[model samples]
Target: MNQHDFLIALLVFLVAAVVAVPLARRLGLGAVLGYLIAGAAIGPFALRLVTNVESILHFSEFGVVMMMFVIGLELEPRKLKNLKKSIFGYGSTQLAACALVLGVLAALLGAPWQVALVAGLGLALSSTAIAFATLAERNLMSTPAGAASFGILLFQDIAAIPMIALLPLLAADAVGAVPHGPPAWQTAGKAVAVMALLVVVGRYLVRPVLRFIARTDMREMFTAFALLLVVGIALMMDAVGVSMALGTFVAGVLLADSEYRHALEADIEPFKGLLLGLFFMAVGMSIDFGVLAQAPGQVLGLVAGFVVVKTLILALLARRFGIARGQWLLFGLLISQGGEFAFVVFGVAAHAGLLPPHMEALLVLVVALSMVATPLLLLVFDRLIAPRLHALSRRKDDAIPPQHNPVLIAGFGRFGQIVGRLLYSQGITATILDHDPDQIEFLKGFGFKVFYGDATRVDLLEAAGAGTAKILVVAIEGMEDSLALIDRVRARFPHLKIYARARHVSHVYQLKDRGVEIFEREMFEGSLMMGRRVLEGLGIDPADARSVALRFRRHNIQAIDRFYPHYRDQTKLVSLARQARDELEEMFRQDREQRQKQEDAEWS
Candidate 1:
């Protein structure tokens, strides 16, 4: 396509996504499906807005690589080691079972054994991006179901490495080598060598380089280096006949221990999010409406059969693994769809002469359709099935006692207690609410007025006399719960002064945006105290150290206020954070120099 056409296509995609994603999310379908629908809406078969999808697909594949890299960053060595049981136990068994069953089913449908094997393996993989994104969006990523899903997805990522190498072998000629390709053993050796090289270089070379860039305090430079690292590793792997996605993943794991992990993530996340969206759009664009129209029954049969088989297999595996019924069902539905890797595998197989053009197109359509159906499936299960399951299992609870106090304290945990105690010492009665049943009982034993209920609930808030309360202290550990409670207070008890405890700068920004003017991060004061102690340990006067810490704290709070408006733009936020850090350091240095001069003058 020409430059003009490319720009037009880009505009079309951005516009479609901008319009469709919010609407889809508002309607309860996730962003992945929204992007897909958007792509289909503007595709050649529909509006014919952008016909040349092939080029965009190739370009957008980097998003998948970036995603794998981000996933790797999350999987620090400690975390990966922790997942050993899930990865080997449930993960391995799940893949093997799904592949075996799907392969058998494909063979029964008249495909040759080898082709059936390929199909089975391709279909066995699930959409990691979509699954994790959905789980995280709904605050389930830390739950049993999310953990299980993540473990399975990590295994699938690892499995993709071998599968990529194996595909060329599956399509190898009768002479035991691919056409113009090296022998299977040689290919395998080269892939292993490439992986080793990536690890060694990443461990030794990359960290120092990243540290050097980070020390420069230029966020853009660091981001560029981060991108270069991921893309460069991917290209190297691709040159050596390994999957680029696998290469980026390996690089991510290697950099997991680097000090710049968070910085790299901050820099790379926006790109990853955008590119992933583009990738989904590309998937939607690649869907063949004509083929679907020609064999609607066949296509629908394939889609339905794929979902049923995968879901049943996953459910059985979850059962064997002793997963809870609710979680197992959610897991089954989330992963039943075909993944992005299927497109690459299908392409590889077709090029290797294993799959016919028609079969490749058919498989592609199946994968796309299945992906499109996943979010809808999740919505149905979450909205319809999950509620009934919970209703059946939920037990009746004792009524919460009415509490009428001038001050209402939510989340009487570590932070909340200090606030509560301060109020108690002054004889200011504050009704404390806590969700932890055991903790509530323990606190009540200590003669503290703590109640058992979620503070975010309007009824519970009302029970706590929120309408009469003058100040609301939200010190919840869970960020979402804390934000929910803040929202409720703002809407219902706007007269109450809300003093929130934020977990981090992001939380501070959220609270700031919501008109919670009086909030402090839980760790900021503690960290400043530690810094003050360190200064004292370094021979600085204790009083001076305390002053320095207080000044730094004030400056930081001011910086957060200044930067809060641009929090949504990660790059700008990172830059602002760096600038604030630099400014604080410079201020401290100036203070120390001035203090030294004054001491010298006094001695003279």
Candidate 2:
């Protein structure tokens, strides 16, 4: 396309996204659907605004690659190792079972075995972008269902590599011709070698390069380097027949422990979001509305058939894997849609004569419609089904026996455990209530008497002796949960003194607003201590370092209180922050001068 045409297309896309996304989000649908609707409206079949759909679709797929890398950055090698069982077990089983059932059904319906196999494999895959985005929207990524969904998606991405390779052999079999390509063993060897090289380079070489770039203190340059890393890894993987998403994900995992991980994520996030939205738009444009118009029943039926089949299979897997009963439907619906990879598979199959042109178009439509359907389905479930399920679970919740412990501790994780242990050592046994079943089980094995119940629930709090307890410690990890517990206790038990843990400065502000004066920022003390140790290591006297740390802590607390009223005003907040920094520095300077004068007087 010419420059002018390209500019026009870009303008159209930006306008459509800006207009439609908020409307969709406001209507309880998601950004993904909004993008899809925008794409369909401007597509050749509708408005004929931009007709070059195929090229745009292929280009926008890099968004998925960037997303995978960001996800990998969150998952260190240790965490990935922990997911091995789920990855191979649930992932492999889900893929195989879905493929077998779908393929067999297709063959029985009179499709060629090759076509059936291709369809089965392609349809079995689910959209990683859609599932992750939806999971993140609902803040469900840390839930069991979310982790399991991630494992299945990761395996599917890895499996796509071999599936692509197998396509040529399947095509050759159907057409009675020898496939012309490198032998399977040679390709496999090259893939393994490329992966090993990426690991080595990512582990040893990338950090030094990133550190060098960061040292230059150029934000744009650092961002450019981050993009270069992803694109370069993608090219290498594509050359060796590995999935680009998988390659970049490995690079991300390698850098997960790097100090620059957050910087890299921040740099790439905007590009990833924009490009992913464009990718969804491209999918919407590619949907064969012409075919849908002519054979609406066929298209709609296929979409329904595949979604239902996949949902049932995933639900069974969720049950067998011991996912919470309440999450079974959620787990199924989240990933039952056809993925972006299906477009590539079906297009390649059509090119290789394994599928006819009409068949390929039909299958692509099915996949796109299924993608569009997922967000709507999830919306319905969230609005209608989820509330009822939650209410039912609340009704069936087990009761905790009333206790007379002097203290009540909620959330017995690392933070709460320290408090509990210290109290226990001092001959004070507090009643502990933790919501995580796994944590409660593990703690029980250590001979600790703990109750498993949600602390946010008023009944649970009352039963745990919030009414009679002298002190209530709100140590829940989530800021919202901690604030909710504080609100509940302050409302019901006015006599109880509540101590809360704040996740960050903003959390402290919220807690303070709710009248919680006794709150500790979870990492503040430890970080201050570390800074003091660094100062001591830098040749400062240990006692002086201790005094400086205490002074800084006091200054910080005063600053927080002073800034509280202006926190809502960003301009005033920034000005006050600058003023506070200058005041602290002036105080430190005076302390140093005073200490120097004392030393000189002693020497005289």
Best by lDDT: 2
List TM-score per model, in order: 0.71, 0.80
lDDT of model 2 at residue 206? 96
For candidate 2, which ten residues in a row score worst on lDDT?
A: 393-402
The TM-score, computed over Cα atoms with residue i paired to residue i, of candidate 2 is: 0.80
Give per-residue lDDT, candidate 2, residue 157. 94
lDDT of 1 by residue, 250-284 (tens): 78877888778898888899999999898888888
lDDT of each: 0.85, 0.91
lDDT of 1: 0.85
Candidate of highest TM-score = 2
TM-score of candidate 1 on Cα atoms, chains taken together: 0.71
